[model samples]
Target chain A: MDEEWIKTTDKKIINLIRLTRKNTLDYINKDINVSTKTTRKDLVTNVDKSNEQFLVNNIREIDPKSKILGEEGFGDNVNSMSGHVWIIDPIDGTMNFVKEKNHFAIMLALYIDGKGILGYILDVMQNKLYHGIFGKVYENDKEIFSPKNISLNNGLMGMSAPLLINDYDNMQSIAHKSSGVRIYGSAGIQFISVIKGELIGYISHLKPWDIAAGKVMCDSLGITVTTIDGNALDMVSSETVLIATKIAHKEILDLVK
Target chain B: MDEEWIKTTDKKIINLIRLTRKNTLDYINKDINVSTKTTRKDLVTNVDKSNEQFLVNNIREIDPKSKILGEEGFGDNVNSMSGHVWIIDPIDGTMNFVKEKNHFAIMLALYIDGKGILGYILDVMQNKLYHGIFGKVYENDKEIFSPKNISLNNGLMGMSAPLLINDYDNMQSIAHKSSGVRIYGSAGIQFISVIKGELIGYISHLKPWDIAAGKVMCDSLGITVTTIDGNALDMVSSETVLIATKIAHKEILDLVK
Candidate 1:
């Protein structure tokens, strides 16, 4: 994809996201019709599927030859980030959507031949959108600078309940050494907190759709996003993801390692 | 205070809270000048003191002879909840206010002759107020019905990081048995979640101002508010507080025991 063409596509995709906001809000305000996936903890709702279909259809209309990897399987079975691929998680925090009715997001990203071109994460209820183009991050229309570099002992950390209980990779110690721990039950919400400089870092076992959009946003802001160990992220597979400031990143990896 | 007098007082207090919203918002949006209280984790800002003074001055004008218990130490030190006492936590979750700027709240409660007459928790950013009058709970003037009676394993629980890390009273086991765990870092926010039926229970070590208003609201909705060991809460002292749906309360007590 050409650079100029990618800019045009970004505007179109953002408008599409804004257009779908009302329908998603309606579904969230009303009773959510839900069904379980692999486990009872894993939930899928009508809104999740409908939102995915809505995005996938519009993307297909805009770029007929583009490949899309969607959470609800409405798009292609993308094995790799080939030319002109869009990755989306229509509703990243489906459990929060079903139960709390807040703290969830609509995440979408665009890649051109294995390189991220654009990323967007829209917090549905708050109406706040985090977008990144190439290597610039923006909240709404204003570009966001890098958050202050704080260490693990001076800032809060977000963790998964499963990891905390099982003490996976010495997570308990990582949590103990941080200023405090917060668990909002949504990976997207946690990611936004880090982007806004509220949380020092976030660690959880996440699928590709869960971290794809967030990863781009973090990378643009000079934040570190990698596995529990200091390693590069495999964008096509589920991995133990850790996102943090530079100082906290090294401290957490040392403890968890 | 008589019943009619209490009603009038509630109206006046609500108006005062509404009037103070602008000043609080100004402080939060602008630079918040913060100071350390006992430790760095325990924070007190200029806004906290100003909000406390605002409430105390208004309450004194209304009832000059009344006693007040305040977090900022601007009010009277009443050893007993003798008559016409007010408890105010100018800003519950100050850490959240200073850090997140969205999850903190203004909490106030009125007790007449050692009986809870009114309680209010205002989520400043969201403009949602949770109040109760003598066993009747309301969310911004709309009456709230009782939350469903769900047991521990069937519902989500909100807990604190200290409790989880120390495994206080076997908290880790309780968290493991529940559907999942959530930590919002604000006791008032967690209380509102329970009142709104989003969380089954919330447990934390809280001061009197932290839980006084929330206790009144939860009791009105038939939710259990008590010590972790199932003992009655001491109204004038700090203690470990647990707010939960009735069934979950009993189950958690059994497990902790």
Candidate 2:
């Protein structure tokens, strides 16, 4: 993507995200009926589906040729990361949305020919939008500086419930070594915490939409975005994801092994 | 205290809490320095001491017979809660204040003749206040009804860092059974979440001041607030505190045993 074209796309995407925010708030202020998803613990709501459709329609109008991989099945049947692809989770942390009415996020990512070109994660309740175009990342409009490479022993970490319960990848030990642990129940919110230095790292099992935008934002800040074992993640599947500062990543990976 | 006298004192305490808010915000917006308390992770700032003094001075002027037990040493040294005793944690979650600039709380409670009479927990950054006098509780000015007595399997739970890592009182198993686990790093914030029905319960090792205000608030809602083993908490020392909805309390106590 050329510089001018990239800038134009970024502006359009930002506008679309702001529109999504308005729609989400409208639904929340009104009555919402929630339903369960895959398991008794997993949740989905009418608002989630409506939000995804709204985002998909706008995104399609912005770039008709682009393929969308959305959480609510309103997007294209995408299999390969070829050409232009927009991945979105209209409402990440659906459980939080249904239960707490906070801590949920809207995330979107654009990849061109297998390369990430842009990303956005909006913390709806807080009205904080973290975005990155190519190598530049910003929170709202202010440029964010990379935090010091603090190690696990000196910083806080975020973990998923399933991983902690099962001791998957020795996560229990990794959590024990970190200064402390936090679980906000949202991948996008957790990513924002790591980027802002509020949390040193975050690990969880995430689908592509759950982490696509967050990964792009982290990459721009030189934060480590990889598997729990320091391996590359498949962008099209659910995987154990880890995002952290450089030293914290190394420390966590060492413990996982 | 009789109903008429209690109602009058409630109004006065509420006004005092609102006034204390202004002073705390002034310190936060200004440039301030922080120092460590017992450990590197434990922190205290000048803002904390100033807030405590401000609250104490106002309380003293409001009621001269009161004995204050404050986190800072400015309050009167009272060994027994036999009279009008005020317990205050100037800034709960001090580490969060120095680091995240959020998730900290201001807590105050009044015990009349060893019985809790009034409580306040102010979420400074969000500007939300939860207070109760005797059996009536309010959030800001709106009255709060009792939350549903959801069990452990159906609601989120909060745990402390040390407790989670050590799996103390079989917390690991209890966390595994709950709908999910959350660690917001502040007992006051955790309590607010539980009272608001965002979390079903919260367990942590807390000092008297840390859980004092929260305990009083929970009591009004018919929520169970006690030790991990379903025993009454000592009002003058640190203990393993558990605050939860009724069914959740029984379920957790069973697991702990």
Question: lDDT per prediction?
Answer: 0.88, 0.86
What 10-residue stretch in candidate 1 chain A is worst by lDDT? A94-103
Q: Give the worst 10-residue stretch by lDDT in candidate 2 chain B.
A: B93-102
Every candidate's DockQ is 0.61, 0.54
lDDT of 2 by residue, A67-94 (tens): 9999989999999898899999999988
lDDT (C-alpha) at residue A227 in model 2? 82
The regions of model 1 sitting more than 4 angstroms off are A29-31, B29-31
Tens digits of per-residue lDDT for model 1, A1-257: 47788789889989998977777988777777899999888889999999999999999999999899998899998898778888889998887777667788999988778677888899988898999997889889998888889999888899998888778999988987887789998888898899989888999999888888888889888899999888987678889999999999999888976
Candidate 1 structure lDDT? 0.88
Chain A TM-score values, per prediction: 0.97, 0.97
Q: Which candidate is the best by lDDT?
A: 1
Model 2: lDDT equals 0.86
